[model samples]
Structures are given as structure tokens and as C-alpha cells.
Target chain A: MKLTRRMFIQGAAAVTALMAAPRALLAWPEKAFKAGSSDEVMQALFGSADVTESGSVVLNAPDIAENGRVVPISVSSSLDGVENISVIVVENPSPLAASFDLGPGASAAVSTRIKMGKTSNVIAVVKADGKLYSAQKEVKVTIGGCGG
Target chain B: MASDIRIKAKLTGDTAEVKTLMKHDMETGTRKDKKTGETVPAHYITEVKCELNGKLVMTANWGPAVSKNPYFAFTVKGAKAGDVLKVSWVDNKGGGSSAETTLG
Candidate 1:
């Protein structure tokens, strides 16, 4: 094989394509993460803040969080066609904690740990069949997780 | 460098429960250093993906509020034993890591 200008250009193009593939496949919602309020986050991520309170969307969390640094939370839904699940800490500096997009063959349940800045309501929002449903629980934090 | 992920996938009935623990600082950028009195820069995983046998089953987008050393668990239907399950993540600083496990 011999090196040529055309080969160099072709190689550069391939490298650029390779680097661009992941960004195109998975787009991180930077605006939503920077949103200070839950409503703003909802608007940035889903384009709406209208969420119906539903019992079918279950949010499991501790009643009193002794340490706000690592509060465990789990969200599960009995509704069919559950497409997305998000956890929001209402009192955090930026409320949107985590968001999970469920695909086909994936269950409508997820568990994770989050940091809470203060005692506040933890909202679990589920998107099923293009409709948004939510459930909230208040967790009291003795110590804040933000700073001293 | 050593891998930054620990994963386990177990098959129960017809579903495979996949759990992953990622090693990260998850700094919220709001916290100030106690000694320096300066705000620490935010460093956290922004995206996580789970694939079963080369097909994506789940994707998660995280904010700075996620705890340090995040633990995440989910289930995949129709996953059987010996299926390859891969969990990977990318952080805000362009750092990324991945780990794979077989459902057993």
C-alpha cells in the first residue's frame, strides 16, 4: 500500500465519522440537566409540564433520609408501554436527577441512588403510551448533601 | 487503567435482572471545598446504555444529583442465560467506560 493525498483525506473522513457516531446515537440533554426547576426540566426534556398523578406509577423511597448524600430510590410502573422514567428531587439545586428511556423488551422499572440538597418531594415521572404519569413522595433529610 | 464498572446479570423466570455499579465522583459543581473554599467542578456520568446480545435494551441520562459511585438496576424481558449484557457510560468530561457480563 502507498500513502497518497486522497487516502489521507479518506482516512480523516472515516475518523471524523467514527467520532461523530456516538454523539448522534446518544444525545445528552444538557439543557434539561442544567434546568433549575422541575417544571423547566420537564419542559426541556419532554416539551411539557402536564403530568397526571397516578397510582400505577410507584415510587419507592425512604421516609426519612438520615444522609442526603446517597438516598436510594426505585421507580416501577404497572402501566403498559412504559417508554420513559425520570426521578426528580424537588429541592435540589437542579431538580432533574435521572432519566431512563426504556426500549422494547425492557421492563418499566429502575432503581438508583441520588443526592438531595434538602428535605423535599421526590417525584417519579413515567411516560407510557405518549402520556406522562407521575407519583411523588416526601423524604426528610437530616443533613443536606449540597455543601456545608 | 482498571475498569470503572462492576456488573451482574441474573436470569429470573423470563427476565434478566441487570445491575451495574459505576465508579465516579459525581460532583454536583455546587459543593465548595472545605479547605479551599472553592467550588468543585461537576463531573458525573451523563449517559448510560445497556445492551443485550448487541441490541440496546435501556438508556439512562443522569444529572449531577446522582450519588457518587452510582448504582443502577433494571430488567430485560426475553433475556436468557448465556446472553451477553453490556453496560457502558459516558461522563460530562468526555470520560467513558464499559463492562460486560453474561446472564446466568
Candidate 2:
């Protein structure tokens, strides 16, 4: 219990060794595709996003997914002149998710099927001209798929 | 095994539906055998093609970005009833198969 230099050095060595381990070992390789948490996905998308409780960006997905293996997701934006759109799955191994490039004269909507691996909140981040807007929905995965 | 390749499709007035399943290992090139520690070679499907009534309808380019047992669904116009829809896929290993279904 007394202050000992030898003990402190030993503790420091252990801590350093623990930090040396690979990041993948600590967390499963969910990557960006398995995003399941809404809040975390937005945080990943904007670092901090201004999300209002509005139905401007229609995120279509089952409130309760019958299976966790595969879920169909669709994101459509009502804002005119939509320039860019991204989808983030918060709880997935990777958090940045998928991004779409919407050029001028392009439709402001996108729909894609993504693998969840588990229950997650799917979030859509839309970039209009120079502005950023977002919409979110909770998708519950009842059964794990994609080797979940 | 190659014997498991399958493709099922249908074409409706102004719309086409296609479904396909392929036999593949889909190894991501990162996974290693638990006992051997030797890295497994990547063997995944990389592309899929679906034609509606003999016209190109949907083409999907998949990379290591896709998951195993990949399934895709898409619709395209210009397909009339009583036409033929064909689906095919080419894997990373270059194994390919095709199947055709008549419009309903």
C-alpha cells in the first residue's frame, strides 16, 4: 500500500501492454454496415447533427424486423436540390456507413438494402447544397444474420 | 458446389422482377482457419446481371463490400407480360450460371 517505485513500474508495463493490443479484438468487426443505433449513427454522420422531429426525410423500414439477417431500407428526402446523402448504422463495427453522391439535376432520393447483423438504428444524413439535414428510425433486429 | 446455382424471375406489364441464388464461399480474404492460422483465399461473387425480356434490366457490381449469400431485388420498366426474364451471376472465381423465367 505504500508508495513504491517498483510496483508503479509494473503497473505501468501492464497498462502499456493492454493498450498495444489490436482494436479489432476489443470490438467485433461490425464495420459500417451493421448500424443499429440511431443516436450513434447521427453522431458519426455529423459529429453533431441538428435533427428535428419531422417527417421530411422518409426512412422506410420495419419498426420491428422479423429477421435480423437482412433488412430493406429506403431514404427519400423532401428538400429541394438535395445534393448528397449518407446512411449510418450506429452500433455496427464501422460507423460512417454508406454515402451517395447526388449531383445537380439528380433525383433527391435513394433506396438500398443493407445487412444489420443485429438491432440497430438506421440514420440518413442529407447534404443539401451547403447544408446538412438528417432523419432517423429505429430498426429492431430479432434474429442475427450475416454470421451475427 | 456449382450444383446449387439458381435464378428465378418474372416479368409483368411495365415491370420486371428477378431473384437469384448462387453457390459460393464468399471468403472476405481476412478470415483464417481456426486451427491452421493460414489466411483463406478470397472467393466471393463480384457481379450480377438480370435481363428482362432479353433487354438488360439491372446490373449489380459487388465487391468485397457485400455479404455472403447475397440476394438482390430490383424492378425495371419496358417488360411486358408473356416475355422472358433471365438472371445470371459471375463470382470472383469466375464461376457463372444462368436461369430464365417466363413473364406472368
Candidate 3:
């Protein structure tokens, strides 16, 4: 192919225009997330929940996280009946990501996945019978997370 | 792949405080595959166990209907400050989790 002055100018202009395109224009407010381990989040969510460890409340996660960017956690209760269920993480800039309102007939458990910016503790706090309780586990974040 | 799962415990008179955070993917089955033109098989931990010093506190099970990562918080009785508390769980694929903490 032969090069032409007019063609070169046109290509350059197109390249510049493409490079100047704004990302927000491509995907405006897609799926936003709150980053944290879990503990920092529950404390902020509960404030002061007479929180305690209960065998009736169970939380399950991995022992070693292949990636810290995405970790899974589960919280459940078997206290005859459940009033509410909530999930929180500590370490993110904004800790509280979700809060579930459980009614008299609602399930006694709520499970969800969370992104950890780094190695930190995953905390789960439960509210039952007008009282508050909590549980936590240390997620060994090996891979890069939020910043990485 | 976390090891030595542990929880924190505190005691204020008859009230026992326990905190736990497990490590697993509460995977939502709505994601797609980039290369196969199909969806990736739903994979996640589906169950958990919270024990207060060897006594069953709570047990929870979930499915793709849950969130990405999950956390649970609650309180139990019969545990005193300086005593031991144990937590464990079994996943959908038979994976197991265990953690221990001391009250106060």
C-alpha cells in the first residue's frame, strides 16, 4: 500500500478522538461495590449490639483464599425463629455493603460473597430477639485485591 | 484456602459475645463465560457451623440465590471469659471449616 498525506491526517484524527472518549460514556455506574474484610464493617453496622458468639449462628468461608479480590462468606441461625440477617466486612473504605430485613416467616440465614482489598478478618453480626451478636474469621488473602 | 479459622469472644456477665467471618464464594449463578459461550457451573460454599465451646450454635445453608461473599454474626450462652469456643462448617462440595476462639 502507498501512504498518502490526506489518509495519514484522517487516521491521526480518528485515533485522537477514540483516545479522548470517556469511560463513563461506555458503562455508566455499572456494578459498584464496597470494599472491606468484614469486621470493620459489622462494627460500624451494629454500633453496640450486645454482640456475642453463638453456636446457633454459623458462618462458613475458605481457609485460604486463592484471591483476596473475591471471597465468600455465609451466616445462619437456628434460634427457634429469626428476626433479621445482615452481612458486613471490615477493611473496605465503606464497610457495610448489605443489610437484610427478616420477618417472622423469613429464613434464619443469609449468605453472600465479598471482595477483600487485602488480608483481613470477615465478620458476621446477627440480631435476634432484640439483642445483637457477632462472629468473625481471618481470611488469608494471598493474591492482590481491591487496589491490585 | 484459609487455615486456623478463629473467632473472637468476649464476656460481660452472663452475656457471651462471639464474632466470625468465613471464607467462601456465595457465587451467584448469573455470571457468564467469556470463552465458552456458556455459563460457568455454579460453584460456592453452601453451609456453615457456629459452635459455642463444642455446642451447636447455628447452622446455615445457601444457594446461588445468596450474595457473593457471606458473613454471619450472633451470640450464644454457656461460654465464659477465658473459655474456648469452636466453629466449624461443611460446604456444598463437602469442604470443611473449623475455627476456635477464647471468650473475654
Regions of model 2 farther than 4 Å from truth: A1-114, A117-148, B1-5, B10-12
Candidate 3 docking band: incorrect
Off by over 4 Å in 1: A1-25
Q: Write the per-residue lDDT of candidate 2 for residues A34-147, one digit (tens) a residue.
A: 344555544543455556544677778788777654566666687876655666666554444445545442345545455555677777777665567777788888875444
**Candidate 1, after superposition: displacement of residue B93 in Å?**
0.6
> For each of the candidates, what fraction of the native contacts does it recover?
0.91, 0.01, 0.12
Q: What's the TM for model 1? A: 0.89
Indicate the residue-level lDDT of B82 in model 3: 70
Docking class of 2: incorrect
Summing lDDT over every window of 10 consecutive residues in candidate 3 chain A, give the lowest-scoring window: A26-35
As a whole number from 0 to 100, the lDDT of residue A6 in candidate 3 is 80
Clashing pairs in 2: A30-A93, A31-A93, A31-A94, A32-A94, A35-A89, A36-A120, A36-A121, A37-A121
Residues A1-148, candidate 3, lDDT per residue (tens digit)?
3568889999999888887677334321112123233443444444553577777777787877787655776677777656556655455444553455454423465555566556666666678776776677777778734432
Error of 1 at B94 (Å): 0.6
Give a tens-digit lDDT track for model 1, residues B1-104.
Answer: 23789987779987988788999999988889989999999898999999999999999999988999999999999988888999989998999998888888
TM-score of each: 0.89, 0.50, 0.42
